[model samples]
Target chain A: MTQTNQPEINVQEKRPLDTGTAESTSSEPRFSPQVDIWENDRGLTVVADMPGVNADGLSIDLNDNVLTIHGRIEAQNPGKKVLTQEFEVGDYYRQFKLSEDIDKEAIAATIKDGVLAVSLPKMAPAQPRKITVVQA
Target chain B: MAFLPFFGRNFSGSFWELEKMRSHMDHVYNALADGFNQIRRNYTGVFPLVNISEDEDNLFLTAELPGLTADRLEISIKGETLTLKGAKTQDNAGDETLNYHRRERQAGSFSRSLTLPVKVKSEDVGAVFKNGILTVTLPKATEARAHQITVQAQ
Candidate 1:
C-alpha cells in the first residue's frame, strides 16, 4: 500500500467564496454528492455519486488551490405540477483544497452511470524517492 | 451556500459544524443505501428518493438510483400504490485485499412504495432508466383524465 500524507477528503454542501456563473432552474436546496477519495503511488482518485447528473450539466473548476465540482439536476418534466416530492432536487456543489503536492494541470475527470471520477496526479517533485544504502 | 470544506479555514468553528452536517447527511444517505439488505444500521426513513409529477395525461415518477441496472431492480403497481424494490452490489473488481482509504459508497437492497394521486392504467405504464435515474410514466385511466368544460357566451 502506498503511503499518503494527505488528510481525509472533506465533502460538504457549501459554495465557494468566489461564485461563478452557474444558474439553477429551481429554488430547491443543492445537496453535496457523497464522495470517496483514495490515494496511491500514482495520484489521488475521487469518486462521487451524483445521480441524475448528465455530462453536459457537470462542471469542474480549479482556481488556485481550491477545486470545485458542480452538477445540475434537471426536473422530471418541465412546467409540470409536482404531486409528491420526497427529497429536494437541485444542483450539486462541493469543493476541495489541493496542496502543492498535487499537479493541477494534470487533473482528469470522467462521469459514468451518474458517478463522477476525478484523477489528480501528484507532482514529480512531490513524490517520495527511495534512498539507497551506501557504505559511509 | 455555506461553509467551505477542505479549503482555507476562512471562518473558525464553521468547518467543524459543516463536518457534523456532512456526517449527518452521510449517515442518512448510507442508511438509505443499506435499507435494501434489512441488515443496515441507522436505517430510518424512506429508501429511494423520488419526485412525482403529473402532466395532462400521464404521471411521472423519477427515482434517484446511482449505479443500478435493470436486472437489479423490480417495479410493480398494486392498486393505487407503485412499489420500487432493488439492490445495489458493490463492484470491487474481485480484489478484496486492496486497502480502502475511504469507503462511503454503499450497496444494499431497498424497497419503497408510493401511493399514486390518481388512478393509472397498469398496462399502459412505461418506464425508462437513464443515467442512474429511473422514470416511470403512468398513463391516467379514462375516467381519471382531465375533462375540459367550455362556456358559451351570450
Candidate 2:
C-alpha cells in the first residue's frame, strides 16, 4: 500500500465580489459580513454572521473558482416615528476564492439562525489515507 | 431633507445627476459607519450592537446576536434600566483531536445594561427572538406616556 500526501491547503484572497462600478442611487446599503473560516483534513468550512437574513433572502454561488455569498435583509423599519436607531438595515455581501484542491462539485452550504456555514470538501486524493507498514 | 429636490429631478437633465447619485450613495454608506461610531461612543462595553426606538406607548430595543438561542439568554428590567445577559458557546468543541487552520469566532458570556429614556411598565415588557435578533418591547409607564394636547380659541 502507498500513501498520498495532499498538497498544502491554502485559502486565498477573501474580498468583496466585484459586481460593477456603475453605481445607482439605491437607499439600501450593502455591508461586508464578518466570517470565520476553519479547515481540517477533510476540507474547509466557512461561517458568516448575517443577522436578519432569512433562507429566502440568501444566495450562494460558486463560479470560476470564486464563491459568492449574498444576503438581503428585509427592512424592519416600522411606520412609527424612529426616535433612535443605532444600526442600519442593509444587505450582506462577501466572496472567497477557492483553490483547485477543493472539490467545487461537492460544496454544500447551510444556514441556521442567520448564520451561514459553507463546507468545501476536498478531492478524493486529498483525503488522508492510512497505509500499513510491512515487517522488516 | 434638502436632497429630496435633487431626487425629484428628471434623470436625463444632465450628467451631473449620475454624480449626484454616486455622492448620495457615499453619504448613505458613511451614515451607516457614523451610526456605529455613535453607538460606540454611548456604550463603552457591549458585545452586540443595539438600537432603541420609541413610540407613544412602547419603547423598542433590538439587538443582533447571531447563533445565540433564546434559551441561553436572560432579560430583565429594573426601574428605568434594561439588562441583557447571555453566554455564547463555540460550536464543534466536542472534537478534541481535530486540527484547525483558523479560528476567529469568539465565544463567552456577556452582560449589558442600558438606561431607558422614559420610565416603563416592567410588568408588561415583552420580548421576541427571531433570526438571531432580539426585540424587546417595554410599555411606557402611565405617567410617562405621551399625551395629546388641544388648543381652544376664546
Question: How many clashes does each candidate structure show, in the order listed?
Answer: 4, 0
Per-residue lDDT of candidate 1, residues B1-154 (tens digit): 3445445566536767888999999999988877754533224336676778999999999887777777667899988899988776654645545445676766566777778999999988888887788989999998999899899899
List candidate 2 stretches off by more than 4 Å: A1-27, A126-136, B1-45, B94-102, B152-154
Error of 1 at B150 (Å): 5.7
B2 Cα displacement, candidate 2 (Å): 55
Cα deviation of A127, candidate 1, in Å: 10
Give the chain A TM-score for each candidate. 0.68, 0.72
In model 1, state the lDDT of residue A127: 62
TM-score of chain B of each: 0.67, 0.68
DockQ for all models: 0.21, 0.20
Candidate 2 docking: what grade? incorrect
Per lDDT, the best of the predicted structures is: 2
lDDT per residue as tens, model 1, A1-136: 1113322221122222233586555556777777777777778788888888989999999998888999987664577889987566667888988878898889999987778899999888746789999999
